[model samples]
Target: MFYDHADQQAEAMHPNPDWTTTPITPELIRGALDLETTQHGVLPHRLPARARAQCTDPQLAMVESQPSGVRLLFRTRATTVELDTLPTKRTYQGAPPRPDGVYDLLVDGRLTGQATVTGGNTVTIDMTTGTAEHQPGPPGTLSFTDLPDGIKDIEIWLPHNETTELIALRTDAPVAPMTDRGRKVWLHHGSSISHGSDAASPTNTWPALAAALGGVELINLGLAGSALLDPFTARAIRDTPADLISLKLGINLVNLDLMRLRAFTPAVHGFLDTIREGHPTTPLLVVSPILCPIHEDTPGPGAFDFSALAVGALRFRATGDPAERATGKLTLGVIREELSRIVRQRSADDPHLHYLDGRDLYGERDFAELPLPDELHPDAATHRRIGERFAELAFTTGGPFTGHNA
Candidate 1:
């Protein structure tokens, strides 16, 4: 007997007949701006479909689907829960094999369980040529049994780095959207650091940790390698419902060597302008890049450290000349200076606008103590440090997110 695709998928999801299977729906998800229906299941997207349609770059497409801060939010009395997912795992030709992405399950705001899905699709990337080939695989299930008995809020945080297509949610009891707890909503946008590169788990990402500490609901638009101050991204921020907002700028612009200092200033202005169109008086904070020694003075087009690559390790170094800054070449120093000036100028007429030095989150002192492992992304310990520092700086009494600005 032959089975169709849907039948096979259904069979794969329902291996244990006793559990009540529930279709994953919009209300059950948070942090994702949109969801795309696929043959296997529903894929969450950080950016809306309209924004995605505007660009065909594969990097942007892949990062948005990775669901950096996305999670399933519900309240249930279930003692056991299982979710079927199709994850697209990535691997570079020469580097060490990447670990399976983790799913963090939170019970009533506390981390109670964690699991990783296996046997999903894989994408092999050629680091030298920047080409990628996809190979399909089977779906996998993440099961968490022996949850607490009482009715409690449940949050299953999707992997911060993997492209996960959620297929089904099964539990011993019924579930419903978790009731609001009166927390402020924080919507943040930034580069890979904010996307949780090297973070231990989804809930351990800096934004996630900071949100937890700040007592706010989080909506992370932290697109890896794609926070290029694009108009559509700004529009997405403009349209998203956020009580507090932040934009972490500079790193991606400098590293991609995407523009000159001349183009960079106006791009920052236009991006802020678009956000203010909808969020006219919302508390908006502009954050500059963290201290990256290599790119601090040197212009980029950051390149992989071929020496490290030869030993099967991953590392990056700035490739552009420091002298090129004379011809308007962009560097971290250039971007940070420009961002500070822009925010200061904009804040004159907009009291709600604020500025933050990203170094305050992860500074030179912190770097000396816990340097970036890849010279690009923060490690798990650094993520925790940044999260703690962010909460202290931005969510505390005198911080921008604490009170309304006149």
Candidate 2:
């Protein structure tokens, strides 16, 4: 997959590799396990006996399974490693504690072991008593005591949980070669709204959910408080190879008040131009932001929300002319119109370029039905709604996002 000049440079600098054929030597296997332990912050959930057996060509597979449906995988060899799971932080008002569940591990297609994550870790602060107390509970760990030699495959199974998440998978060994499977690649960039700010599960983030719904591999470049039209980011997009691509714009710029209308329009143009340099005909969808009342028509001073201060939570906000905003001066709606117009003009020569109103994903009607908790980021339910809408609008049959065909 060849991209434009910027993309070619990025590919050369950080080439994506195939990891399937990479031989899993003992050293490599140990390195993989160590990497997983360190980067993933948790041990591999399960490992079958065959995973411990020595083999010339070792591989790990994860097939959907149930009870809890937690899958597991293991590297061929093992070494002493410590794994830990981080607790989830409550980022929203009335957010509930995350649930915990069990995950199983399989080696070479057979169940080898399992570990339980008991979710009851509560440290209550009693203002009346002026004391903080810890509730003791069973800790979570998976240690394989005995094993046969010649291991080859590993898998992991995680039941539903609230407190812990499978943020990443890591291996100390070099990445294996790319598998010979056709996996759709998704490239997306956006604001903190896309960064899983108020989402419930790690996998429940809108982009993650949309990927699952569309069955595509994802490269999320969603940065918190930083989707402000950086040329480097556009260059990054230009350099990456993707079967499909989307850019969620507008709200971040309006909320940040990063640039005036004069600058915003040209920046948007330049951003799209840079991406086109690499992906001239890729199915590219540019989306505006969801409805945000405060910053809808107003510019922002980029201040943090003090409302949560009463509850001891810090939230970011964009400040601007409320009166002018009320008169419909500066809003995501305004930007959406401009962006659509730009796409329409540019698409005359670039038919592959497309535009979608953010309202299509979440409109004023929906906002009235399910309002955002912090006036900015959506709740978990809203994330699910947005993901489903995106998948339906962009990935379903006859949808706007036909990927390679588009």
* Candidate whose lDDT is highest: 1
The TM-score obtained by model 2 is 0.61
Q: Candidate 1 residues 65-174, lDDT tens each?
A: 99889999999998878788999999998998999998998899999888887778999999899999999998877778788898999999999999999988988888
Which regions in candidate 2 have their CA more than 4 angstroms from the true location? 1-180, 313-318, 322-330, 403-406
Best by TM-score: 1
Q: Please give the distance, in angstroms, between residue 187's alpha carbon in candidate 2 and its true position after superposition.
A: 0.2
Which regions of candidate 1 fall more than 4 Å away from where they truly are? 1-12, 15-18, 404-406
Model 2: per-residue Cα lDDT over 1-406, one tens digit each: 1011322222222223431223222232210111123243433212222332322221112110011122333554432111223322212233333334434444544456554444324444333343445554323333332434443555444432223333333232333322323667777878766755566644566876787678775556555556677776677678767778899997777765667667778889999999989988888888888887767666775565656645665455666776655444456767888889999998899887889888888889999999887778888899899999999888887676754422
lDDT of 2: 0.56
**What C-alpha RMSD separates each model from the true structure?**
4.0, 14.4
Query: What local lDDT does model 1 show for residue 242?
Result: 89
